[model samples]
Target: MLAFFIYGCDSNNKIWEVFQEKDLLKHPYASRCGDCHQDIYNQWKNSRHAKAYISEDYKKATHNYSKTKCLNCHIPLELSKGEKPQIRNFHKEDGVNCVSCHFSSQTNSMHGPYDVFSPPHPSTKDEDFRKAFICSSCHQETYKQWKKAKVEKTCQQCHMTPVEKKDLIQKFPFHWFHLAKEVYNHEFKTGKIKDLKVKVKKEGNTLLLTITNNQIPHNFPTADNGKPKVYVFVETFKNDKKIEEDNALITPKFAFIYNKPKILEFNFFEDFDKVKVVIYRKLSWQKKKEKITEKIFNFK
Candidate 1:
């Protein structure tokens, strides 16, 4: 459950609501996102968000699970209103694409920093919609950290800050970086996630777990150089009773050697009956890593 409270009837708030809602398949944005922002359409075509599902990370993460849950964030509009794809098309869909956020039919009246207007979609357009809450729909943990720090901003405050430009289409570009100019516009750079999976096995009250970096195109957490962690955790319970726990932190430097199915073995007393394996994010608040855990039974 989320502790953050959303408010008001605005575009930002509506977007947040859409994120919180379990079913947004029938929303207009899911079908009619290409009407406006033709320029963004071309730019996003080559963006990381567009490639998220096709990326190695996504494939490995959803390899064995129902594709629907993964596609909700990766391909926002694919399964809307009972529409399911015969075969998963990663490149054509997936991730938090442009249409996912700016699907309204409203017009932009204000321009420049702190500018606010009704985005071109049927969704509600209000003050909260213009804030970072919209982006927080996916990056809930980062949003919590930002809220805890009392930062006076949203995800776009840092990720989409406009940069001054004289040789560009306008004076300011919402995204302003030149790292991947050839592949796509530097201004439209979105973060990438690597697939990290953990498998657990049991043998005579003892548990052994392995983790692998399955689908990282660039790196486990992101393509851009930064500090992050890939860690494994073990928690033991005996007949529904708490027993012991252990955690291991792995970094990119360490991952180079231990990238394979790195093994972690755990021994439990005959009294213990269950074990849990958690592959959680240890990266800083800014990395926006997703956390996953698995549990298994052990007979003693």
Candidate 2:
């Protein structure tokens, strides 16, 4: 195979020196990009995206990869804005790797939120890279809910929390040429979940707990193709002694809609003087539930 690149530099144009079209679309691999973007690669390596195809939970759910539809998203070959991705045969182990999300056949270049001249590959400045549609293909429902909420925050703003400015690349020569810009964490964490708005009201022997998905603009505990659950645990006490404990479950079918409230009721004797409520969420892909927010109420 012949390595091909047109070599020239004048601060305005950079002919491909290290990457040819075949190196990108035909022989795709994340490590090739990691040659320069070491920091970003390390962050992505530890993310759920890195394990999308290899996750035990995903494999178990798919019955050892028997479900073909599940494979596409888990080991997507490429991603197009507002469209579901197509599965690739090679590098399936990489799961949702760099090329899956960044490289576009449409543009025949890597798309990002910045404009830059690079010797290794072709780069295109794309506004869609900063928008929610970039994630809409995989996060269908959440994207829909986000649109309904009509907030200004994109999914990246929340999940890909911004980090301090630094060289986008780690290579010495390349690192010095590019200006530092706000870098987004490639780990893809949702960060600290905003606390939900909750209130407890007592009407004598009747107790009501209302939970509102405040501040968040999407459905709480939402998922695209998997079932996610939200649990509301309630406890009642009379003079500091817990007398009753119960819970209500909320699912994606009836998820905590954007700004709407879901009320749960507990009927007890009029003697109860205090109440405690705790919320937990079990995402579709997780085996354990984690506590989200909790509140206590006292009536003297």
Candidate 3:
């Protein structure tokens, strides 16, 4: 393997050789990786992973960087190490960049789900990149919930849907020779309430509503920090006149159960002719709850 020394000066003005790997010397920054993998970089640029350190909500919640505990995950180093990575002083703003998950200290190479013949950087295929436990250190609560649910589908399979692409790299010497392949999208979108199943029924003077996390493997609002909530509102009407309304908030806390139905019951007047149930969700960092869906039933 070819190796070279890359010299750079830190804040202290002392020169340091950060990498002895030959290819790494050319691409030290995540932005440099974008030179070839433009599409993946753009997708990551719009994801929560990219804004982990710079998000306004996260900054406000951490009390303007007073909470050191939140820094580890926000500006993580090598995640493949299976430990809480130290916050990087250099490029701290990048937040969970391509190197965070792909870099391997042991092999001193980029680790990925696929074996790639990259001339710009040394790479190795690691199976751990395909597993969910790889994310447990950062997403502890969600990982536990997924484990309890005992589902076979991995986190990447659902969040990073695969697509057919012609080239993984751009402007390379072997670019034209490479064929199309299936690659996963890097957006990493989460928290979809569209697949949830809601059932409502009236029994005597009480209305029962069941909300099931049918498509998700974990809880509806799953996270390690921040208070994500699911709101259930019930309104009763009699003869076109508004009578009474009630609402319940479902907040997933530590040790919250996943992949189960949350049943809510509302008691209404016997003469009530109509009932309306509305579901709303608020992300932990969001200022307001957004309506997901609503159901109206007539008992008259």
Candidate 2 stretches with Cα past 4 Å from truth are 1-22
**TM-scores for every predicted model:** 0.38, 0.90, 0.84
lDDT per residue as tens, model 1, 1-300: 112122234546556444333222223332233333344455566665666566665576677435656555555532222132122334344455544444432332212222333223233334544466654545444454445545455555445544433222211221221111212232344443334566767776677776665543223433122356766677788777888887777665555221446677777665466776666564432346456545464555
Q: Rank the candidates by TM-score, best first.
A: 2, 3, 1
**lDDT of candidate 2 over 1-300, digit per residue (tens):** 121122224433434443343576554777878888999999999898888888887888999989998877888877866777898878888989999988888877788999876656777898988998999888888999999998999999988988999888998666655678888999998654558888888998788888888777788878887777989888889989999888889888888888898888888764688888888888766789999888889988
Ten consecutive residues with minimal summed lDDT in candidate 3? 1-10
lDDT (C-alpha, whole model) for all candidates: 0.47, 0.81, 0.74
lDDT at position 229, candidate 3 = 89
Candidate 3 to truth, TM = 0.84
- lDDT by residue for model 3 over 1-300, one digit each (tens)? 111221122212323222223656332567777877777888889888888888888888989979988888888877735467777666878988888777767777788877665555567888877888788878887888898889899898888888776577665543543455667788887746674576878787788887777777887778777678878888888887888898987887621255577678888766577888888888766788898888888877
- Cα deviation of 14 in candidate 1 (Å)? 27
Best by TM-score: 2
**True lDDT of residue 278, candidate 1:** 66
